[model samples]
Target: MDTAVTSTPKPVALITGASRGLGAAIARELAPTHDLLLGARSADSLRPILDELPGATGWPVELTDYRAVAAASASIARLDVLVHNAGIADLGTIAESSVDQWRNTLEANLIAVAELTRVLLPALRAADGHVVLINSGAGLRAHAGWASYAASKFGLRAFGDALRLEEQSLRVTSIHPGRIDTDMQREIRAHEGRDYRAEDFLTASTVAAAVRNAVDTPRDAHPTEIVLRPF
Candidate 1:
């Protein structure tokens, strides 16, 4: 009789907005090595991919709700990585954008992520985990129609930076992924201009690979920020 028992993986990652696009790509990239806990608005959209991954679990979550995020955190035993990638972009001049649109964008892009990080910090601290904030070039610079989106991302970047200082023992990375070929980019093109070349956009897979690299790096060495711009 063979009594050998296989050991489970050590590092575990929890990623928000894992249904599709950059989030999905990141989840796929990490699925091979880490146990992934994916959260998105719809379980139906996440199930297909989650089923394919060996060590993964999916939870349908509306990130804007603080209670829901807190509930999700309670279920997680330990976490080695937290990817705050759930965000909504609203493009328009400050005057042109509706009040509701601005509020919704801020709620999803900034406030919710902040709340989730607050709830999950204990677990992350225990594991000495890495926290990856999916930021944008807009966070670093201002653009014409990026009033709301840019403001939200800029706030998030500030939060990530401050949090990094607070948690000196943990790794914090804020990545500004430029022009990814995702639905978000398509929306930008539709509202902004079609003159921008899709070919120049970075693939979600590329951003995903970068995320995995950050997670796999040595604990002592931490890359504070990385800006990936496609040529």
Candidate 2:
């Protein structure tokens, strides 16, 4: 008889828009237990986070470029977690919006996400992975001047719901967070002509922690949706 011990391989997680903000925070939170694939539009953009997390690899590909996304995702034979955090907020009322604005917004936020998830379904299924969508409160409600952005998020939430039903082995989580304090929030405030107050919005770390919690939940219980708001 012989006795031997071998370490299990760490689970793999891929986070889009991981160059900064909530994506990076979630990467940091999962680094200890999982090998990370940090995705951004360009390698240059991913350099900083890749440097911060030496164990992470850069996955540079524009999500809307379906050819590039398919090629890029081919290398992953198995994936434990997939976080859809990349999205555009091209806010405008229906009257003010253009064909191009609506097309671009949906292309980036909804279609691209669907394409990525479709391509990665095999890999995710292999690992019985978890999918996390970083949605906004706009997903739950539409506000004036936010038609396009809100539509994309609402679609995202619907997508998550569909995926949960379709992929019974995989866990799908939609994190619907209120305004978050980040550079994006600042820009949104500037567009609204309002003051940028960090206290008024949720912190990136807090949202990331919520993601970590969903990912860490026991296998017996599925974490389907997590709604977050600032105090």
Candidate 3:
């Protein structure tokens, strides 16, 4: 019914770890306006979300695979929004945590993020895009048992900070939110020997809204860092 000869193309937004949890929530929030690129570890995992959201493509790849990420960036000529939402939290005290856990956490949370952003810089620069890092409350302050995860998030915060300083044209943000009612939280609760309490945590939708708000903010102003605590 609505036929304009040359309509402006919608801005493209790519969200990693978008198969579920906060990543899926972000995809839903942006679906109304943006051309979404839903990224996940497996295409099968993305089937459900792709079915629910029209016109969104599922990009399945290992973030740690530098070659694959480089190739994926090539397909995206212009990226308006890039969300670093894929991360793993290894919760344990320094004494209890192994070297492998620390390495794995840093590899996924910080190194991969940096690598992806580096590869995508050309596309982001073409659009003057915004980069959003989904950091944790632990990023601001490390908890006793969450040393390894906190370290990785803290590193992520630093990465965003440095990116903001180095790239004058791009907007970089670090979002620090408290524990959300996610499957990841359930796994954390099991490790802590506590009952899963969904009511006591932030919902993914709420956090996703915060992300959308930042993206919608006026270009004249930059929302550098946003922190969200459960209410």
Task: List the candidate 2 regions with Cα displacement exceeding 4 Å.
Answer: 1-4
lDDT of 1 by residue, 22-130 (tens): 9999999998788888989988889777777746888788887778778878977678999989898878887798989889888888899889888988898888888
The models' CA-based lDDT, in order, is: 0.87, 0.94, 0.94
**Decoy 1 TM-score against native:** 0.93
lDDT of 3 by residue, 43-108 (tens): 999999999996899999999999988887788889999999999988888998899999999999
Q: Name the 10 consecutive residues with the lowest summed lDDT in model 1.
A: 190-199
Better of 1 and 2 by TM-score: 2
- Backbone N/Cα/C clashes per model: 0, 0, 0
Give every collision pair in model 2: none
Deviating ranges (above 4 Å) for candidate 1: 1-8, 195-197
Give residue 27's error in model 1 in angstroms. 0.9
TM-score of 2: 0.98
lDDT by residue (tens digit), candidate 2, 1-231: 787989999999999999999899999999999999999999999989989999999999999999999999999999999999998888868999999999999899999999999999999999999999999899999999999999999999999999999999999999999999988899999999999889999999999999999999999999988999899
